[model samples]
Structures are given as C-alpha cells and as structure tokens.
Target: MSQGRTTEGVRDQRAELAEANHVLVDQGILDGFGHVSVRSAEDPDTFLLARNLAPGLVQPEDVQVFTLQGETDDPRKPYLERYIHSEIYRARPDVRAVVHSHSPAVIPFGVSTVPLRPILHMAGFLAPRVPVFEARDTLGSGSDLLVGTAASGAALAEVLGDAAVVLMRGHGFTSVATSIPEVVYRAVYTGVNARVQAEALRLGECTYLSDEEAAATVATNTPQIGRAWQYWRDRTA
Candidate 1:
C-alpha cells in the first residue's frame, strides 16, 4: 500500500523492527508483555509491530503492519496495547518509534508522587520531569490500565506531549523517539536511571541533571547510540 516503496526496503525494515524487539528484551526493557514499533518507512500513517508474540520470540514474519488508527489486515491477534504505538505516531510526527514497557525499576515513580528524573547522561532524554498518565481520568474508574482504546491512547499521547517518556499510573511507561534505536536507548537508560535515582534517594536527598546539562548530554550521546544498540543486538543473538 506504500507507493513506490520497494519490497526489499520493507523487508529490511521488518528485520530491523524484529531486531529491536530482541534488543529491548535483552536489555531488560521489555519482558513477555512490552512492545516496540517503528513508523512505516514507506507510509507515515502506518507502523510495524510484532504480533501477539513475546518480544524475545518475535521474528520478521511475526511483524505486522498497523495503521495510525491501529487497524491491520493481518488476522493474527495484535497486542491490546498496540494503540500505545498507533496514537503516539499519530500525535508526534517527529517520533518514528515507540516503546511501551512494564519496566520494574520505573514502576514506583508512576504510582507515587515521586518524579522520575535524569540521573545519568545516558538517560538525559528524561530531563525536566516525566509526566504520569492516569487512565482513570480518561477511561473513568475501575478501568484496566492498558491503553486499549483510541481515546485513551490519545489521552496518553497528550500527556506525553513533548517529553521523551511518559509513565502510566499503576502500569508502565511509554517512550517515543525519532528512531527505533533512539527509543530503545531512552527506554533502557530510563530504567537504569530509575534504579540509580532510587538508590540515591535511599541514601539522602539527591541531585539530578539540570535541563541545560541534560540537553547538552543528549546532544553528545545520541550519535553514539549505535554502540549500545550493536552490543545489545549481539547479546541477543
């Protein structure tokens, strides 16, 4: 459905997406539940994500195409939280990839008033403060925390706004970025930063990266993201 998009290019994109799944799982950013997606290279209005399979189990053939509205022609079941990727790509034109994960280290910040801040240069993308999305406000009370509907997903995107990551209350976190590697980088470092921040808090009052420092570090580190990606890819292999 993508005009002038080569079959080989699409195949390569599928392979890259599948590799992302393995990379995230290997980095502990994703488990049996989380997912990652890339905006279709040939079609901005669509994205590519693995089917209902676990991230560590996803292969190129398990990847499927999904519209920004989260529709897909494939009969196989999609992740119920696929809307997390669809609405993010829809809301943020600059974000070409999305990651939704129930990362353990970052879970407490989402539920408590404690804010998740950038404690390390690798996670400078989380500077300022991470916004937390409350599903109850959008879906009413007693709702499952999953972003299953378009409206709920859109609400989460609204909270995500211009930030690199948004935490879901009592759930997990969703990260967005300009590419798959970048989003994976953010997701992984965010968890690490959370763990470090919690330890610092346990000791005493903690210091965090200033906005200017965070910006500067992000500029310095982004180009080297490939190093981390390659290492994770090899580990997964």
Candidate 2:
C-alpha cells in the first residue's frame, strides 16, 4: 500500500518485518507483551505494526498500516501502545524502525537510578547514558504507566530525544534505529548490556566505554549488523 515502491519491494519489506518479530522473540527481547514497528516505505506519516497479538504469532498478513496518529482502517484490534510507535515516527525522521520490549534484565534499571550504559563493545549504541521516561511526571499520579495515549506517547518521544533507547519506569524500554535489523540488534544488546552491567556492579565499580570509544564502535558495528540479523533470522526458522 506504499507509494513509489514496487509491489515486490513492499512485499519483501513486509516479509522482513514479519521475520523481525520472530527474531526478536527468539532473541528474548519480546515475549507476549511487546511489539515492533517500521515506518512506511513511501509515507512517513504512516507506519506498519501488527494487530494486537503476540510477536511470535505475527505473520506478514497480520501487519497493518497505521497513521502517525495510530489510526488504522482494518477491523482487527491493534496494540494499545501503538501510539508509542506512531508518536516516535512523528518525532524522529531518522528512525525507520522501533522496538518496545519488557525484557526482564532491563526492568530493574528503569525503576532505579542505576543508568543503563554500554558495558561492552556490542552495546556501543547504548553509550552516553540511556534516558528514562517517567509516565507519572507527565501523566500525573495514580496513572497507569503505559504510554497508551497520544499525549503520553508524545511525552515519551520527547524524553527519547536523539537517544537510541529510552527506559520507561515500571514498564519497559523503547529502542529506535534506521532499519529493522539495526533496531533489533540494539534492542537485543541493550538487555545483554543491562545484564552484564548489573553483574559488574555487584563485583564493585564497573568500567564503561567512553563517548569516543562508543562512537567508534557504533560506526564499526553498523556495517556488520547483517551478520547478527542473519543468525537471529535463521534461528526463528
């Protein structure tokens, strides 16, 4: 349904998006409660997300197009947090894909002052300190911590700013990147980084990558993302 792109091209992207959902589930980045999305191939004002269903259950046919306002014409139910992806696309032109997950290792960091930083080279994308979005700060007290509304979603997007990942207090985290594979890599490594960093902290003070080192490693890792993607994609099959 995208403009300019050939039918085959659109089909290929949809297939890849479906594969990505499986890959994330295999990577343990998403279980039953999380979701992933990609910007439309031809329209920035709209994006692609699956109807409300578990990631492992999503097929290419299940993916539906939704406007930046999180509106879709399909009759199938959509994720309540679709606004999270919609508002982020509204905010970040560079981000072609987004992943929202409740990965276990990452939950503790979001509720604590302990920042999630790059603990290893592969997590270089997480350097410069990941930001946390507090729903209560913007939504007021007695509020459920979901980014379920457009205004709340917009607030979360603002907190995400230019960072690759943003943790939500008592919720989970959101990761953004230029493509599906790259975003998956970031989301997977983020939990990895969190686990390692937490373990290192128990051993005493931990060393983290400097900004310059993280920047260099990110540049080096970007080109090699396809390698990880291939491995994860194969595991899903």
Candidate 3:
C-alpha cells in the first residue's frame, strides 16, 4: 500500500478509535479494562493507544504513543495492557488494527473449553473454528493474560493463521482487521454469535454451516462491511 497514514490520518484514527471506545462502552463491549489500538498513521514503527482508562471517558488527547517493539518504557504515559496491541500489530502484518475487550456474552465462550464456532448467519464467516487459543486465563499468579513476549506474539500470529479473529481461552477476544470498523464489526458479530451459540447449545445439537458454506458466506458478505460501519457510526449519534 501507500503507507499513507499521515499525521492527520493517525490523528483521525486516534479520534475515531477514541470515539469507537465510547460507543463500544455504550454498547457494552468495553469498560475500563478493555482497549483498542491502531498502528500509527504517521509512524510505521509505532502505534497509538489510549492509556488505561474508561473507554467512554477518553478524549483525543488521551491517546498515547508506543514503540512497536515494546522495549522502551516511558513512564509519563502508558497503557496498562499495551502488549495486547503492540504484540498483535508487530506480529500480524495483515492486521492494521486490533480490539481487545471483555465483552459479556463473548467472555463465556472464552472460558469455555470448547471452541466458540459461529452458529448464526453473521458468524458464518467464522464457522467450524475461530482460532481459539487454548491457554488458561491465568498463567500462575498475576501474569497478564496475553501471548507474552514477541516470541509468543509470533506464535499467536502463526496460530491465528490467516483468520481475521482469535479468542484467548479463559480470557477475552482480539478482533483484528485492516480497519477500525472491520475490527469493531468483528467484535460485534462475535458477541452476537456467543448469544446464538448459547441458545443453540441449550436446545441440544444445533446445525452449523459446513466449511465450504462458511467460505462462500464470507465472500458473499463483503458488502455488509460498509453497512456495519455505517450502522455503528449511527448508533452513537
């Protein structure tokens, strides 16, 4: 691509993601513990994320900068869970953005031993498997529930494969894509699927689309991307 993420673009993305954070909170996708980050539009080696604060309370100035490699520790301003964003962006080149949230319904499936497959029309894109990471919610004591380290990040990137999303077992979800709207859209659909899967699981066995059907559904659902972006944009208005 053009790498056209100018200072203006990054600023705009920061504002948009900031606005998205509030909307996400309004929609119950996030509270104070969750986060959203985007690769810096002006600097490829860095990313922009809000410091650990209530998503809905964030302002444009609340966004801070961080090195992509995660080596430096600037104490002035920092995100409590920067690794989730830094690691994902550093590891997954295809992922331009990532959203980490402890969404209610989705959190159940995260702790579920079984994979959270898509059982609804919206989730057909994630049928069969959604790259569920089988790690425990807590490692030992107080360690953060993330891939841990660049090596682990690379492992997660590999395990995530070419899929657009991944769920940490016993933790939460990381919906990733090339745009903020795409990531947000995936996060929304994921929660919806969690609700559907819960209901379907209640009624004994539930029918799900075959692998081929899932692939076809993704191809056919391309246009919904714009619609989803528009709908969410209007939601907070």
Candidate 4:
C-alpha cells in the first residue's frame, strides 16, 4: 500500500475512527476508559486516536494524530496507554487498527488460567490461543499493569505476536485487525464469547469450535463484517 492518501481518504478514515469509538461504546465493549485507533493511511508512521476522552464522547475534532513513537503534535496529552497502539503498529505491519478495552466479560479469562475460546461462530478468531501479557514479568513484581511506556508496549506486542487478540493479565485486552471495522468486530465478539463461555462453564462442559470449524467460520464471516459495521454505525448515529 502507498504511504500517502488523498484528502478525502484521510477525512473518511477520521470519520471511521470516530465512528469506531462510538460503536464500541454502544456495543458495551468499552465503558468509560477504553480507546480505539487506526493507522494513518496517508502516513504509515502515524496513527489517529481521540485524546484522553471517553470513547462514547469522542468527536471528530477530539481526534489527534500521533507518530509511531507515540508523540502527538497537539498540545493536549494523548491517552496514557497510547503506547499500546503505537508499539503494536510499529510491530505489526499488517495491522491497521487496534482496540484496548476493559471489557468486563473478558476480564476473568485474563486474570485467571481459563482461556478465552471460540464458542461462537462470530468469534472464530479466538480459536488461536490468546496469549496473556503479565506486566509483572515485564515491569517488575509490583507495577500498575499499564502499557504506559514504549518498552511496556513493545513487550505486550511481543506477546501478541500474530494473534488477533492479547489479554493483559489483570488489566484488560487488546484486539488488532486489518481494518477499524474488523477490529471492532473482534472486540465485540470476544466479549460475547467470553460471556457465553463463562455461562457454559457454569452449566457443564463447553464444546468449542474445532480448528477446522473456526477456520471455515472465519472465512465465511469475514467478508460479511460490513453488515455488522453498518448496523452499529446506524445504531450509534
């Protein structure tokens, strides 16, 4: 892909980024403190995100562009966890968007040994083992468990490696994808799968999708993400 985009392309991406923030909030994937960002189509070294605001309240003007090094041109401070998006973009060339959420339903699997699995077709992306990033291992025994620094962000990205999602032990989780809509899709379904898996575990054994099943479902569902995206966009609008 080219490292430059037309003015219209940039404007459209900004709107999509803003819409992603609201869609995530509307879906309950993000409450008061989560964030979403998209890599700048005009410049591979930069990405765009809302500045230190609740996802639901983000407006187009609230969006700020930041370098891959996590530096922003705006005088206002960016999100403290902005490094999560920066370092992930630095590490994963194919990833165009990232979402960091303290999704309530997904927290248990992150804090415990229970693995988040693909119990539903919509969340087939979870078939790949979701790696857990323990901040203590990278930041020391007593740390805030926040990927606040470039070093911490890089460490978390290393754990994420090629996976669609990574669980931050005791913190939350990050979802990555090739587009903002796909990342939002993964983030939403991840929470749904977590909730369903928990309920199933309480009842009895839960039969997850097999590897082949997951692959097939992903192939079938990936192209239809526009439907969900449109629904979310309309609902939020």
Backbone clashes per model, in order?
Answer: 0, 0, 1, 0
Instruction: Report how far off residue 117 is in candidate 1 (Å).
Output: 0.5
For residue 83, model 4's alpha carbon misses the true position, in angstroms, by 0.6
Preferred candidate (TM-score higher): 2 or 3:
2
lDDT (Cα, tens digit) per residue for candidate 4, span 15-96: 9998999999999999899999999988889999999998888888889999999999899878999999999999999999
Model 1 off-target regions past 4 Å? 1-5
lDDT of 3 at 60: 79
Candidate 1 vs candidate 3: which has greater TM-score?
Answer: 1
Tens-digit lDDT track of model 2 for 1-237 = 545455666677788889999999988999898999999886778898988999999999999999999999999999999999999999999999999999989999999988898989999998787999998898898887888899999999999999999999989999999999999999999999999999999999999999999999999999999999999999888
lDDT of 1 by residue, 1-237 (tens): 544457777898899888999988888988888999999888899999999999989999999999999999999999999999999888999999999999999999998878999988888899877999999999999898889999999999999999999999989999999988898899999899999999999999888899999999999999999998888888877
Stretches of candidate 3 off by over 4 Å are 1-5, 71-76, 136-155
lDDT of all predictions, in order shown?
A: 0.91, 0.92, 0.73, 0.93
User: What tens digits encode model 3's per-residue C-alpha lDDT throughout 55-139?
Assistant: 8888877888888775445455565557767777777777778888777788777666656887766776576577866553234
Instruction: Judging by lDDT, tell me the better candidate of 3 and 4.
Output: 4
Q: Which ten residues in a row have the lowest lDDT in candidate 2?
A: 1-10
* Residue 57 local lDDT, model 1: 93
